[model samples]
Target: MAADGLDEIDYGILHLLQQNARSTTPVDMAEQLPVTDTTIRNRIDRLEEEGVIEGYVPIVNYEKAGFPIRLQFSCTAPTKKRHQVAGQALELPHVVKVDEMLSARENVQVLAVAKTTEEVNEITAGLDDLPLTIERESLLREERRRPFGHFGQHVVDD
Candidate 1:
């Protein structure tokens, strides 16, 4: 292990997994690293057990899936109750993601997807019921994500 606790092997596993978890195989990862396939599997198991490797989720294109309306709501909640408010926000039907921020104002960020304006209103109503102040709301145009860079060596495009 390196001084930071995770050595090159661990970081390689994380990088490959993050790149494409569904298509990644232990054998494929082992082929890239110096370890065997069994070692790759064992390392993945240990990472999961240690909570370093959390559950994987698919990135859905809501616009193509018929839920074209994507909304982002910035909200403010009592600092002491921010976590609970975020959890409650997640319970709403259209709400997909809730972020609890560490700040005085706009401490909560909510992302919701809906098929129509009514569903959006329903989400807004549900949030209104909570002890939060809706600061601003905007329609999301597009979003993109990539794996953490420091976790592994950067791969150049061909």
Candidate 2:
């Protein structure tokens, strides 16, 4: 509703959608958020147009889907080849997410899931072969991840 940034209603709509994007409709959000359905629809369209709402994705249980090993890799590359190396990592098997970091030491963060440690090693080996990759530090994820939420905690209702 504001020219510069999101307001209370916008944040509330986002919160409800984040909780359950697939089932949450504008009508349902309007009932819970004290806004009209038309308002909700407008806000959502604005959010999408502004790229705030990128896209929706289904949450998968990787462990139950036969991929239990979760690995995190922090990698660094030369400034010239940083983007090239990161793009190459995305094409590797089991690579789920690849993020570019601002830090000087490690500029790339990769999240991968595999069915076994062997698969993790294979993925790492493929990454290591890339040119300009200076260093890589990996860790196995142990804790169970909770569902995505908590974004609304910082939003104040008007």
lDDT, candidates in the order shown: 0.90, 0.77
Residue-level lDDT tens digits of model 2 in 92-132: 88888888776666888888899877897898788888763
TM-score of 2: 0.80
Score every model by TM-score.
0.95, 0.80
Tens-digit lDDT string for candidate 1 (1-158) = 88867778888888889888999899888778778889989989988998998899899999999999999999999999999999999999989999999999999999999999999999999999999999999999999999897775542111
Residue pairs whose backbone atoms clash in candidate 1: none
lDDT score for candidate 2 against the true structure:
0.77
**Model 2: lDDT of residue 127:** 81
lDDT of 1 at 70: 98
Global fold similarity of model 1 (TM-score): 0.95
Which candidate has the highest lDDT of all? 1
